[model samples]
Target chain A: MSIRNKYEEELTTVFNKLIAMCRTVEIAIEKSVNSLVHRDTELAGEVIKEDKNVDNLEHEIEQDCLKILLMEHPVASDFRDVSAALKMITDLERIADQAADISEITFQFGEESFIKEPFHIKEMAKLATGMVKDSVQSYINRDLELARSLDRRDDGVDNLFGKIKGELVELIKKDGRNADQAILFMMIAKYIERIADHAVNIGEWVEYAITGYHKIG
Target chain B: MKDKKQTVKDNLDIFDFTSDIAVNIKSLNLYYGNFQALKEVSMELKKNEITAMIGPSGCGKSTLLKTLNRMNDLVDGCRIEGSITIGEKDIYAKDIDLSALRKNVGMVFQKPNPFPMSVYDNVAFAPRTFGIRKKAELDEIVETSLKRASIWDELKDRLNKSALGLSGGQQQRLCIARSLAAQPKILLMDEPTSALDPISTGKIEELMSELVKDLTIVIVTHNMQQATRIADRTAFFYLGELVEFADTQTLFTCPADKRTENYITGRFG
Candidate 1:
């Protein structure tokens, strides 16, 4: 066998675990939103439960990265790949946590209808989950252009979030009794917005891995 | 012979020419008979910084290091082309004195090669040869050079003892002190720690970092980790060609050339 065969195998394992974690987080985002839209408390419970699996994947990937650093003494692109993986996993874990947060809020609603149709909020969820998946793909492929394009899509998600917040304020103004439900919807919209922001963070890290240039300080 | 001494003195005075660059090689190509060892290699080594040359065996990293001090002149079939300027003087010029050039550019080999003399005499050898007879001056020079090499504290009491009796690490540091005794403007190291244990390697690396405060260092090392640890800039050579040269951080993290990436990451055969 070649000298780097074992190293390459270990690197491949870390990459595969990252893909699996991305998929799990993407599913959690989708299910949490679906549970609210369809009033399926069972689906919300599953998202919250599956969060442990996402956390475990993050821990495993972290260990793999640390081992590569300690043993291989990796340099050049290998060094960047491992360091970037360390940063990207944190964003992924935060995304999973936020998904679980949304599900917990869904449990708060408890058989009552959303104050609004959740139209703009659901749009935000779809866009945010797509950002998460595509950002991980950009990292895997080392695709600079795709990583850059996610910034614009994040702007789209932000605009939808602003629109939802304004709508919630207007609903609360229309009737004082709408305040409680409007507040819950606002929190859900905020979590989806934060998820999109985390996705953008992942994209920026991909840029660092490929070009060593982070978008912000 | 007196004329030669005056010329060497003149060459030594030129080292005072202030410049950020200590050595500049333009379009350098070296050959050993019919075999081309280095092709069109051009690099500027900054003063007071360590630049590391790394590549697979026989890729011309050591050949390039030897060219810095013209040590290749000892090789029977070796021939070189292009200009290598140290400070403002072209070292290959006919009037250039080889002894003065060697004094201005000191070298340490892969293995420790302290003289069979005592530690004090080993550090004092160069100064005495250059015509310092006073014991007081030689004493100061020996003490200063040993301290600069960071081995003075351990060997201070053992000054009268033969250098060959020291441990491998101490012997390497003594060799370094011997080089510093000559007060060279540049130091060329060829795998200076490859033969030593890890602790000794670490000591030599620490010495290099400290020594760079006063001298420009160009080191040829096969150990990539050593290059990354002590070198500010690194050059990657492959098959007589310079594949890439950049800041050590950039070269290791995101090399511009695929060849460099593959080589540094150990993906190459």
Candidate 2:
């Protein structure tokens, strides 16, 4: 193959690696929460081990992004994509850290009764994880509509966080002994909400790749 | 060498050549006997702007330049059709005075064709042809025109020396000075610096950049770099038709059409 095709192929590989890493983290998040809610210590070990893969892929994609930027003086859309990809990975790696933070809480809550139903937590994970996937694909395809669609869904995640906060406050007031568990749950939901926000940041970057715009609320 | 591209008839409209413009052309065609050189060409030169005519040799860039001032009238079997105008004045009208129109719109050739006379007289010659006869007035016009052409300081003391004694660069400056002396609102330059060395070319470019603030200049050149550097806007002509007309930076950096990209990248000429 020609050198240009080879370079593009390598870039495609990097994009695939990032998308796969996002998927893995999404699954790990769901599995990590399941380990606590169902008292499945087996799933907790799996979540902890899965993080090594995220760390490895993150390192590999970061190195490749740097290589592309150094070698190519790409103009216009390609320039935006490479830059956005480099930045998106930083937030992705941090999301991985947040997922790990949620996983560590599983051991802390091992002995306690279920403080509340896990539906809201599960939904937050699903929404943010899907946003991460959609943003990466939108960027790779340069699909402005898809990027904008992902951008809008962040409002849903924010609303979910609000409902979680209100429910926790009422539960704590009803039983003062529930205070510690309620606050810990709120903190976990807060981290998940912030993960949704960082995913929105990635979606905005995708919009920039397609239309050279980064407008947001 | 002049850059040439195959002029696709359907694509020529991209340059948006118009005749209703202050400058008009209609069914304008040229030939060197049996060779129908420019095919049913119709276009215009907009008022008070630098219009660049670019194409390969024999595509009739020089033919069209000469046709403007009726310089092609000297060529054997060089037939012209249709009309060209400046505002309401149709230049091709029989009653239209060729000499007077040429006086109002002066020309500079590919080579620096300064007349073989004193530097001061070369500029003074065009005004004299139009009957400006006072010696004191002539001297004043000479100094002002030379200074405007940016060569007065270099040749101020050598005004009476033979034009041939000046270097090639100086001769081109003298040619520009001569054009300025005509006090023409429009100047047509046909590859005015292709013959000079690099320094001489640089001087002509500098002079052109300076002159355009006062007069509308139309230049025909093959050098893409020179066109990019000096023109506020550029029109790319190929095979007797215009391919693109855009801002200079747009034309050079990200040409809109495939043919423009090919030509600009030096894939073909």
Candidate 3:
């Protein structure tokens, strides 16, 4: 039997923790957007509180990577796994922070109706959440094709952000009275777009872990 | 930006034949009693550098090393086909002096096979074989060889003691000192550290790095980490064939051949 059996088990736990953190960030973004759509203040509060657990999971995975690096003297693919995990956790943490930021914006709107129903903004949130989930799935499964496809998939969220900005600008111009609500909706759209960008970054790290080359996209 | 780094790494792996080639073999084939030991093997050992040969057992790594100094000549029914040249002279030429060839190239074995004589005599034996009859010259050679091998300080006062009385690690170093006593231009070592502790292995590895400034070294080792640590170029042999040869870093991290990758990663069947 290989002596690396024990190290391999520890690595499996790190992989599971990364997936759990992905799911947490995915849930946070979903709940934050749902709260805004349904005017639920309690769900927004829950998302804001869940960010700490994501932070703790990131810390735990980082510690495991460092311990394996020091103890196992990993080479070849094992070396790539540890290094990719280190970079990946940073992007995962950023996604969690952006989710909390979206939840904060939802709290500001309170129970008031949005300037317009947030159909585009909610679509952007769903797309971004799917991206975060799929990117982590690509990493766990070592699916190079799925990771590469996320780069093109990121363009959808970016396009949605541009469309939201144009619509919000027109609403503000239609009446100076809609300026406060229009600007807040635009800020929420920007936060969801940022989450999609972080997911793209995670895909790039997954590619690096598999092939040792991170595409600039 | 990555293209430039990759180009530099590629250039380092290429062998520039315009410079000095210490040892060159062309289509070399060796067989012992109809069992092929080496098949059309050819490689160039760069001067003043350490080249490590690595593979599994009976992969012909040691057979290739032995051919560098014609040590396989003693084996019964061993027939070789092809030419090997050291410098400008063919080592297998009819008129070549065996003593001169052995003098120019020295070898260290797997085990520390120091003679049963005293430490001083062991170091002096190589020089005396070439007919240096003066006491002062022999004494100077003994001191300098021990110092160069990095064992002088430990054995300076114990020169009169038998080499067999030394520890396994110390005896290995003494064997290295004995090899250096001949002042050979090339050193061939077959698993020099396989029998020593890690600390002793580290010392020998350090000594090899220092020795490469003046001598060419070819080592056959089973330990892949040792090759990555000390060798500038690594040759991977498989089933009596020269499979891949490249700079040590490239060979380990991204070997060009799948067999080389499997062997180095311990996945070989």
- Expressed as tens digits, the lDDT of each residue in A1-217 for candidate 1 is 2469889898899999999999999999999999888888899999999999999999999999999999999987778889889999999999999999999988888767667898888899999999999999999999999898888999999999999989989999998888988888989999999999999999999998888777794
Question: Model 2 compared with the native: what TM-score?
Answer: 0.59
Backbone clash tally (model 1): 1
Please give the lDDT score at residue A128 for candidate 1: 99
Q: For candidate 2, write residues B60-134 as lDDT tens digits.
A: 777777877788788899887777776457777777776666766789988888788899899999777766667
Q: Write the per-residue lDDT of candidate 2 for residues A1-217, one digit (tens) a residue.
A: 2235655676798889878887887777777667767877777777877788888888899898888766754433445667788878877877877777777777677577877877898888788888877877787777888878875798899899999999999998999888888877887788788888878888888776666566665
DockQ of 2: 0.07
Candidate 2 stretches greater than 4 Å from native? A1-217, B1-21, B195-203, B249-256, B267-269
Q: Judged by lDDT relative to the true structure, which candidate is superior, 2 or 3? A: 3
Tens digits of per-residue lDDT for model 3, A1-217: 3446777888899999998999898888999899888988889889889999999999999999999877765655666778888998999899888878877888788666778999999899989999899999998999999988888988999999999999999998999988988878988998888899888998998887787677774
Interface DockQ of candidate 1: 0.63
Clashing pairs in 2: none
Looking at model 3, the pairs that clash are none
By TM-score: ranked, best first: 1, 3, 2
lDDT (10s digit) by residue, model 3, range B1-269: 54654453343222222457888988999999989988888998899999999998999999989988899999999989998988656888897766667767889999999999999999999877766657888999999999999999999999999999998889999999999988788899999999999999999999999999988999999987899899999999999999999988777766778788667755565
Which candidate number maximizes TM-score?
A: 1
lDDT of 1 at B220: 93
Interface C-alpha RMSD per candidate, 1 decimal: 2.3, 7.4, 3.1
Q: Candidate 3 at residue A1, lDDT? A: 37
Which 10 residues in a row give candidate 3 chain A its minimum summed lDDT?
Answer: A72-81
